[model samples]
Target: MTNFKITLYTDPVCAWCFIGHRTLDQAITLYQRTYPGGRHDMFEFIYHPFYLRNTKPEEGRMTLEDAMLAKNGTEAKVLAIKTKMQRIGTAHGILFNYDSKVGSTKLAHVLIQQAGRHRGAEVQKEMVGAMYSMHFEQGGNINNLDELVAVAVKVGVSEQDAHAWLRDDQVGAEVDELARTAREELGVTSVPTIEIGGLRLEGAEDVGGIMEALVSVKEKEIAVGGAQDPF
Candidate 1:
């Protein structure tokens, strides 16, 4: 049996990262059902909060509309992409309300890190999912500490602990360091960059493609293991 670690670098505010989350969930489920037994325990997916905006919450942030405009994309282009996302999401039963104002993910990353530390990875994943749902599904601002703390509580994180982590300068610095490491070391300038067993799948990826990548990595691990002679 081989253990595979999948590090998902994502921002809660990214619409496609939300889609990537759903796709990854589906791919994992499909892989388990298709291979059964060993495959289920072989893969472990961990979420790493990536600040795509590279802005601190204390720093004033741009709205979603303004950000797109700054990228030189017209409203029509944005609408077209949203329409496509809606169509694909509907097919997968995932609804994305992109109605919330966009801002930095600094606070959200802090909450995620706290959850992982105090709770566990499973709890952290739930918190991450809730953060995404609040922003993308319910049209809530994840950058708002109140809104974020509510989501954290919903995921079983104590409100007191949540607030403490959010207000702590060390925690905020830790989150910043994570973003720095992802940028400087991992070369991750984009959201939804998934590294599965050292093989990265960046941007939006389809379920089938992600599953194929996972299988390929597993096969490589097996081959490498088989080549070694144990006395």
Candidate 2:
């Protein structure tokens, strides 16, 4: 029932998702400030969960540095990535620690799926931030139930309920739905793919391109009177 909806498909352990998240938050905040109720009934953010590492499970856990090196990215390349991410993160008031352990993002993404339903879209944002910070900053284990519960509780989810749900797997189907929709339906094989009102963003950190695309989409909507239902 919303006119302007942004679907941000991402993984938990992705450094770029965290980066993109910070950028999107800034852009959205700026959007609201500039156009007040321009987003009236006007906006909804659907967080779509997709794992960037699931394609190679046997690959095991790999840090960003290791992943970079394995992919033939040199020390200079790694430093460049680190610098860019840190600069942007600092600008967005986010402190990112690049050396954090990168674990399986599935459970964390699953927690986000559960949070989307149990909590609302707005609260889901907080849940996402907490989980990302845990992995990227505190270096917590996303695969651990206790750690996940702790993250959820830090973001105001009930500690007891979070623990209970860890065993329940109540939202496993919803998590799978996010993955399937992104891959099969939307043809997204990458992380941080954001689709807003039919506007597509393959990489969240691609700032200039995404901003231009977003403005163009907004103008197109205005030209057509307004956004229509995707349902």
Candidate 3:
């Protein structure tokens, strides 16, 4: 069996990233059903860090709505963007809370890194999904160490370990560097950038688009007899 590595660069607080996460899951389910028998084990998912706001810890937390208004320069524009995001999220079974708090995602990314190191990819994915739900649906402040740790614990991470990892300056710095490398080296200019089988899908593509990309990649890989990378 051939293996396909799927790398997702995302920020926890991004609404589109949340939507993309769910959409990718749906697409993977459909792909597995279409090509069953060991196909499920043929895919490996890895999550990387990307910062949309990159707010400093000292800057503290602000309401997501306030941040958007500041960036978009008008209440109407912010409302329109929120409406669009909410509509898209709802279509993917995600309930977005525009009123949630926004702050530095450094600690959150560190938590995910630690989760992946300790628990593996599936558990790491669970931690990611929980973080998205906390930030988007429950209005939780992921920037807060306690809040992040709480979510981690719920996803099989020990509270002590979560607290230690988040409080580690080295881990936080590593996460920051990774986000920067993703932008500079990986050419990831936006959140929810997905890479699979050498094909890159930018932003939150719909399920159909993602599925098509997957199929195209699979076909190309097969055509090449899995001897070379399929772009």
Top candidate, metric TM-score? 3
> Candidate 1 — what's its lDDT?
0.78
TM-score for all models, in order of appearance? 0.88, 0.82, 0.92
Off by over 4 Å in 3: 36-41, 227-231
Which ten residues in a row are the worst by lDDT in model 3? 34-43
lDDT order of candidates, top first: 3, 1, 2
Worst 10 residues of 1 by lDDT: 222-231
* Residue pairs with clashing backbones, model 1: none
Candidate 2 lands at a TM-score of 0.82
By TM-score, the candidates rank as 3, 1, 2
User: Candidate 2's residue-wise lDDT over 74-107, tens digit each?
Assistant: 8888788778877877776667665555656666
lDDT score, candidate 2 = 0.72
lDDT of 3 by residue, 57-172 (tens): 75546888888988999999988998898788878888777668898888889989988887898899999999999888998886887889889989988889888877789877
Q: Give lDDT per model, in order.
A: 0.78, 0.72, 0.84
Give the winner by TM-score: 2 or 3: 3
Top candidate by lDDT: 3
Look at candidate 2 and tell me the lDDT of residue 146. 75
Model 1, position 92, has a per-residue lDDT of 68
When 1 and 2 are scored with lDDT, the better candidate is 1
**Cα lDDT of model 1 by residue, 1-231, tens digit:** 657788999888787898888888888888766743434445666777677775656653455556666665688887777789789878666687656767778888888888888888888889888887888778787678889999988988788988998887898888788888998998998989999878899987999989898677767866878322122
Taking all chains together, the TM-score of candidate 1 against the true structure is: 0.88
Quick one: RMSD of model 2?
A: 4.2
